[model samples]
Target: MDCVVTGGNVKVLAKAVHSLSRIGDELYVEPQEDGLALRSVNSSRSAYACFLFAPLFFSRYTIPSGHAFRCKMAIKSVQAVFRSLASLEKTVEKCHIELEEQKNRLTFTLHCKHGLLKTHNLSFQDSESLQAVFDKDSCANVFRLLVDAVVHFPPSQEEVTVSVSEERMWVRNHVEEEDQSKAMLTELCLASDEFDHFSVQTHNNVTFCLKELRGLLMFAESTGLPISMYFDEPGSPLVLSVTDSVLEGNFVLATLSDDTIFRSLVRTQTPPPPPDDFMNDDIDSYLIAMDTSIAPGPSASGPPTPPLADSLCQKQPAAANHRTRSYIDEKEDDLASSERPPNKKFCSLFFGSVLPPSSQMNTQLVTSQEVLASDSEDD
Candidate 1:
């Protein structure tokens, strides 16, 4: 008898065979376009089982010539059912698969019905289109499939492990706060003077000492006062002196090298006071006039001699060792414990010779002598 199975009926027959027999027992038969002879076996087993019984089952089955059309039709129906199943399998395979292209690399991921199956990488040329896939619009479709796979198969303790890249590790180490602070401290130490009063301490168990000797030198230049500095050791004690013409100060640098010590001294002298017998305005104008007259012209070969003449003219009378005889006699008598000379020559020379010859000069001398007498009385 001839049997024809249509589309829905073919699916039902495939399911029935799948439930009834194992895959090895099933036979896959494809009939040719031309009509062929009909075949039947006397065996009690199913056709699927009988097909595998011999390596060449076509030769074993007995056929009569009149049944050719019916055999061809039955074989064709069975082949159509297997081919439909194969098509469904291929659709499932393509649905769950995903591919990605980035830069010059291509990646493929296969997500089977059971679980994630495998991943693959391939070399891709730069000019190739990344969207190229097995089917039209497959890129978008595969992207959706990848998203589904990611949602279903999340990272688990056993499946996922994270490792830091070498670049990241280097950046983290270099940008650490403590490391940056240390670098800043080093630069500040190099720029600071050795004797500055400020202190800088670091937590790295290492100390630095900066010398402020240059600061002390500048201070002396500005204030006209000498200063000296002394250091015992790095991060240790310091000393300062400010006596007479010598001024000194020192401090410790608590964050420099051990045995790194420095000391600085600024020597200075006090300026002498104006002479006791000095006449201020009178000598100043005279010295100024002398300075102007003796000033060297631009064509002169050497430095001007006016400054030297002014200095010489301004020297005190006592500096020339030319005291009056009465003053000398008084000093000698005081040394010998004897009576002094009563000569008026010393008084006349000081009171008359140095004074200008004028009525105003005489009046001024008299007033000055009276003022001197009043000062001596007050003393």
Candidate 2:
């Protein structure tokens, strides 16, 4: 595959590439018979950008139809080739790209106006294309604005809120730190015609990264086309695009959620532990000792429920062992009472974690007969 970009179109391409470079250091080039696509995503995967240039956008586009291939190169390598886009616009006659399959490299050939030619061989990596499909038709909010109006919008340093309602449409960007909620902001009360169309099926005021939106705005400002915005909800991404006769740029940014909402998600995912300092090893040992309890019959109080320390509440370590011993002794006394009904018998005080509520204890533990024999002389 081979292609060439020349004339003022190179500046537009440069602007798009520059904008995408801010999103990521790596760039993926996809060539097709129709056009070329440059795509990038930021480190945090929060921002994504794609620029597509139609065949007509370039002077000499040559891609064999049905041929398919993709390559990855550092954005810096490509940016270095057009670092002086302003001067290249005047001094460079054209730019050509050809794949050197044998060497596994992309050869960038610059044709200068004064018989000067510079060649750069940029390395590449095997990569796949990134495709994200969203339901634009079902979007809750959509709008279009004159591209140049971007310069007047927030520079992205502050919070940007896009609010739409039946009565009015306005974009407000705070120019201060987040803590300064009332700080001065740039507000544009746009009319219906101010944009190609300002329509919101459902009233919405979505807040998102102004920086990302501003980046796309600056990239497309030179195109002098309209900006198309699509968004569904607060947590979903906000989509922005600019298209002209030559190239189309699409950028998407993940929306920032309120701290409270974010915290709620975290809490839901990981439930807070109970205040009680329960240990599996302690419960295991207690379960192992239960079968050895000496019992006459049922207690008037019935089976003892675990004390707070053994229940859901946490106990201070210094008092833990002492408190647990006392609770156990009381349970043992109740089990040894003669008033206990012959049919009513329990081995130990237990909570949900210690053991199941079966009438008989686990046979694995030493039975009450052995326990009574060992302590007969002392009793």
Candidate 3:
């Protein structure tokens, strides 16, 4: 496969390469009958980007007839070819890309003024085309905005939240609960009328990484195109695209769902243990022992429930052996009682009335047994 880019299109290709570098370290090159496809997926596989440059976009384009293949090269190698976009635009007159299957290399030839010709032969491996599956036309919400609106966001910010309502929209940096005391919060609010085009079939919020968005915006701004976003619910992929007659770009980004945010919040809200003191590991066992002495037995209609103490008491970890010895001794006294009925003693020993009622104790026992069963399954 071979193609030639000349004049202003050289800079356009450079900007496209620069934009793709931000999403992934590897660049996928595919030559098709229609155009050349350049794609990348981030390390986490959560973000994807693709740029298609039609034949019209390039001055000269050629591909072997009935011959199709895909290859991938390090993004850094491609970036090095287009490094220093300022100087590239000034000196480079034309750029040529060709694949040498025999040598297993992708060649880049630069034609510059003053009769200078420079070439780079970079090694690449055969690969399958990287395609992201996302339905853009079926999206319920669509927002069109100028790149300048988000250019002011801090470069250090990792992720941002987009919240839209009937009246307004908010774009803000996402800060963890632990960092709220010290982290800076930056937010941009725009009324519905302020957007270039706003069509909201459903009010929704989504959180996604800002780095790739910023990179794509840079390319859009250079091409004088507005960024269009299409999305449905939070967990669904967010599709951002820039399309024109000759060039088209698409970005699919994973968004954090409301359920994910809620789970994170729940984790952060859990109280921490005391820093100076270590809680006793056998405290629950002791509490159950104390409660069992006074707790009533199961209903007369039902058979006596087996005690959880048999397993709990049999295998005492070494760490808790010292602390639990006294409690075990007390339980032994109840078990040794000869005058009490066997059922009465069994009920008194396992389901004491110290803290919770018999019904509550049964529930606690069932929950503990479930946890143990789960643990065993994991093992």
Clashes of each: 16, 3, 9
Cα lDDT tens digits for candidate 1, 128-198:
11010011111110000001111222122111100111111000011112233342111111112322222
Per-residue C-alpha lDDT of model 2 across residues 94-152, encoded as one tens digit per residue: 78888876688988888888799989998888665544334355567788873454467
lDDT of 3 by residue, 15-102 (tens): 9999999998999999887799998877645678999999888888888687678888899999999888888888999999998888
lDDT of 1 at 334: 34
Worst 10 residues of 1 by lDDT: 139-148
* Stretches of candidate 3 exceeding 4 Å from the true structure: 260-379
Q: Estimate each model's TM-score.
A: 0.13, 0.64, 0.68
The best candidate by TM-score is: 3
Q: lDDT-based ranking, best first? A: 3, 2, 1
The model with the greater TM-score, 2 or 3, is 3
Please tell me which predicted candidate would have the highest lDDT against the true structure: 3
RMSD of 3: 20.4
What value does the lDDT take at residue 269 in candidate 2? 9
Q: Each candidate's lDDT (Cα)?
A: 0.21, 0.56, 0.64
